[model samples]
Target: MRLEHDLAVRREARDIIADDVAIGVGDGWQHLVGRALVTIRDVTDGKVNARQIKERQGLLSIFTDIMIRGSETIAQRVFDVTNGAADQSAWVCEMCGCGGRLIAGNRLRVRCQVCEADEPERERVWREHRDDILEAAATYIRVCLEHSRLFPVYNIVIRVCLDDRDHRLFLDEVHDRLVWWRAGSWIEGVEDALRQDFRRLDFAR
Candidate 1:
């Protein structure tokens, strides 16, 4: 979340928010969170304890452990209010605070039509196990470099590894990073720089 939004919510709901409570969601849900916290405070009569507020799998996840002095009915009310807020966030864009839906991509995210339209294409394979694929690619590059020379030969080997799915995912991520940063080729070092970062590859046989 933006610092201003976070601080605003904290200020508005200071009566309910405990010192250690964490708010770790995006800006789009700021209104929802703020409103919910206020409602919770009102319903619980300023006797609630919030543990955490974060995003999980493109949805809001709020944890508020009610105080011991709180009544069972009030606790249930807090649960209902917080859960309702979380449910509401499912349709709220995490970026621009517009109506959004869960989008399937390299990562699951709630994005409005405009933001979704602006996103780059990502394959289903990239969505599932993307981190693992990138790790495998890194290990492969490290391994290839260790087994082979570092000049034109390493480049040829890395290019050939592109025929494998994992390596291609890594390349796709590299391209995506380039686009994200609006980087020109020379500003970011060449592919060799990427290869040089890898020290070794493990062949699990």
Candidate 2:
């Protein structure tokens, strides 16, 4: 298989395993075992039978081991799988509420700290530069669309207060331009985004 194909398969497998781990965590081990059996049957096209339970048991054990080693590993694997698929990480400042490198030097402060300290002055400047707020909103939308594979879009829409019509429009626009070109297929990224709940891929929200 090609590298992309392999990565895609890994991503799918990881997602499936993650779901199983979640079920196992939420319900009981017996429920996990039952779900595993169902999953094996589904994956194997009903070829898995009573005799295969032992093998499935072993598979489950290995999966649990890998999962227990680190939860973040699975998360990072998903991140790696979707890396470079979108531009999602860029962010504006919180304290100063400025875009493009709000902090300077080693201080890591949002503002220069030398200027705009007074509350009234800060509010006045922010109000005068309302365009910056709009720009930030646009950038936020762009990032949300770009990194949507990391979370589900439905959740994102809810979290971001985007209406269904606007959400679909955003998806269609991104699908037509950036997503299609990058994935070499219109549906792959869209489908993945839908499957992953449109998690933002660029950066943690």
Candidate 3:
């Protein structure tokens, strides 16, 4: 969900959700989650505790471990409500909350017709421009590493010995880029390209 929406739900259901718990969902299921939390709260009379709220296998997954001041029947009802909400999310778009269908493949996603339709074009564009995007990423990372401006946030794993000089330099450069910097106007363009590349790359599988 969006930060604002997440914050709103957290604020509204302060007593039910843990402080560190993250609602791992998109804007589309905001109401479903909000309603579920509210219903759970009302049903348990402000005595339930939710430890996790996330999307699991393209469906809503809410994990609640405690319900104080509730009978066995009430507890069962709570479970039914949570499960029902999760099941309902199967048809709800995770991005826009519109009616959606689960797209089964390498990764599961619940997306509406519009969002699903856009995926192919995104993948097509990424595939056509793959080399350019990769070169930009490499240039950005190399520049950042050489100038000690910043480190790459994403990478492919490397198998290097602990005492390798190249590995040590890579680690040192990575550590130095943790702080904010005026990386450059070019940084924005490179970052945007990299984001698009990374997002569309998942569809290739």
Candidate 4:
């Protein structure tokens, strides 16, 4: 993030966050966090309290956890905003906050080099294999993938558990992305042939 843009974000955050959040790491994720803070302030009618403390910069996106101080309804709204912030990071560069895409592999990463000039050698070991589905429910599915030490940058585990309507909406977004990544980008139709048992999970139904 440029100095000017970074300063601008701080000003924006200062206005909305006001005296509620004392400390935050609003770096690299200025816009996403800024938007969430604005929403949090607006929806809660300035009754919410929150502060971002960490940034989980993943291969596909960035994530952050906030210390939220509010009622249950306010807490739920914070979660929604946080998730939205992370999801929006999928296409935004973790370095410069520009448009970017995932660079998957044994060491999954993203294409921030397009803007920031830092490109690592691509090593794709995402292959046709199956791991035990440790748990699967109507709203979420989990399969063991490479551990964090091995694939530190990639989001090896994705658990999308939401309400029925939100679940479908979220899965629909994942489906569309898979059509591009699983079908077009990475393993051709192999995700379909390989993870065939995935349908049995019945997360959508």
- Using TM-score as the measure, the top candidate is 3
Model 2 alpha-carbon drift over 4 Å, by segment: 1-116, 147-205
lDDT of 2: 0.31
- Tens-place lDDT per residue, model 2, 22-93, is 211100122223444344434444432322111121112212232334346443443332231111111222
lDDT string for model 3 (50-88, tens) is 877878988988888655557898789789989999889
Measured by C-alpha RMSD in angstroms, how accurate is candidate 2?
18.5
* Runs in model 1 lying further than 4 Å from the true structure: 67-69, 117-205
Per-model clash counts, in order, read: 2, 13, 2, 0
The TM-score of candidate 4 is 0.42
Evaluated at residue 53, the lDDT of candidate 2 is 12
Which scores greater on lDDT, model 2 or model 4?
Answer: 4
Query: Against the true structure, what is each candidate's TM-score?
Result: 0.54, 0.19, 0.56, 0.42
CA error at residue 63 for candidate 3, angstroms: 0.8
Alpha carbon lDDT at 23, candidate 2 = 18
Per-model CA lDDT versus the true structure:
0.61, 0.31, 0.61, 0.41
lDDT of 3 at 20: 52
**Model 1 residue 37 lDDT score:** 90
